[model samples]
Target: MDTITVKRRVMMPIRAGDVMAEFISFQGDRSGKEHIGISFEGKTPSFASHVPLVRLHSECLTGDVFGSGRCDCGEQLDEAIDLINQEGGYILYLRQEGRGIGLYAKLEAYALQDKGFDTYQANDMLNLPEDGRDFRIAAQMLKALGVSKIRLLTNNPDKARQLIMYGIDITEQVPTKVHVNQYNHHYLKTKADRKCHTMTFDD
Candidate 1:
């Protein structure tokens, strides 16, 4: 595996609601593409030669940043932050937009979903991979941060397997579940059924 070049690290205060967190940023590379790492201070010791609770979360600018209800991505991100804050771990924020298919294609897929297609089927219609995200960059970033193992927080089992395949030891799996609404119910189901995401819906 190629070593990621850490261009710089900086400390900044992050304010979300009433919670203020001290975060460190590490700019690095994964498979030649730039990636960023944001680590929040936790109650537990940092990097004690064991796997930290790591959330390898992908970027969802529309849902996470803008709070768009088109999907549950935003809710999931908030949940991850809360868990990591409590458990004292790291969140590897990946820039894989639209599951690595990019924003334009994701928007196209959204249109297909509106026309009566599931998320996977919408990608299929667009000749895009159901999920194009690659976690190799995440692995590199983790190693650079001195993380050897991780209790990964995600609903997608493939994420766990992929990270392990990239030489990061995965000690446990943390499931992320969010309530679904009229807009994202089917999209979540498609992820569970087709993409092998471990999500359960009460409704």
Candidate 2:
């Protein structure tokens, strides 16, 4: 396990629309990841699950903040945020740009994808892992926040598997809304086929 134990640093109240939340920050001993937790107020809870809705969202600068149509990162993030705001849960925002390949290498891989290769092949061309991401830090963050079991919101199975390996019980899985565009259709296909993600696209 290469993950460092994270300790709770600060928790402050923040409001988004009618939703009130507590923004939590964690300090890692060695890991250099900016991990955070957003715990919204339980105004209208999801009694169907009887647990908080949790999402482990990796930071995608181009797609998340900039709304790049190259992928569904930003759109899925919006969905998770809205879900949390409504039903009250947590969103663990992890600083893993390009699935931990970082921003520069991600753009480099994108260049390769434009040259007629799928996402996995693009990473292979760049001498990078297909998905260089680790979810143990998210597990650590959840543990520090006193959340051992949750209803996970994600599309990638790896996220849920890794968290389970770290002992977080996944009560349910909330799939992210699929946003397929011409720019990211092939990319998403590669993910579903090669990465074992739970998605079916008409491609």
Candidate 3:
């Protein structure tokens, strides 16, 4: 396997309503999408400690884009951006939509979910892994940015393993706080029950 390299990086202003941030785009070979997008709270060339607040957010077109209530992904993305805007950190927005199953497949899985199958079971019925996302690319992006130690903002423990495998040091695991509606409560529970996600909030 090839060690992912940063092909290009550019500093740009990012505005999410009243929340303003500066982000550096890390482009890889695949192009047209974010391999990694790091949004910081303050000015560039930060004087903060080596252990930065980092969030490895995989792409979720359904939730992150359309604000679908079927899952907590959109809420998580919004929360991550808001927190990073305050705390000063990097939100590595990776292009691993639907846990790497892509958009159309995820919609199909949603149909299966409506048929009473849970998220993982739906993926299983589709012959896909419950979670196909790989955080090694996130690790590589962190290394490229010269960030090794991080307070990883996530609930998934597998993210830690994948980063460790790629030599990234996780100083802390910060579980994401999300707004759970009736539509996503069971989805979140399925994550906690079947996928081993650490969920602290009551659903």
Q: Sort the predicted structures by lDDT, highest score first.
A: 2, 3, 1
Evaluated against the true structure, the overall lDDT of model 1 is 0.77
Q: How many Å off is the CA of 200 in candidate 1?
A: 1.5
Over 83-182, each residue of candidate 1 has an lDDT whose tens digit, in order, gives: 7776677877788889999888889988887889888888888999888988888887888778777888888898888888988998888888765888
Give the poorly placed runs of model 2, Cα more than 4 Å off: 1-19
Task: Tell me the whole-model lDDT of each prediction, alpha carbons only.
Answer: 0.77, 0.82, 0.78
**Per-candidate count of clashing residue pairs (backbone under 3 Å):** 1, 0, 0
Q: Judge candidate 3 at residue 27 and give its lDDT.
A: 50
Query: Using alpha carbons, what is the TM-score of model 1?
Result: 0.89
- Which tens-of-lDDT digit does each residue in 134-186 have in candidate 2? 88888888888778989999888899999999999998888887789988888
How far off is model 3, as Cα RMSD? Answer: 2.9
lDDT of 3 by residue, 20-75 (tens): 65455555535355676675753343544345778888888788878988888888
Ten residues in sequence with the least summed lDDT for candidate 3: 41-50
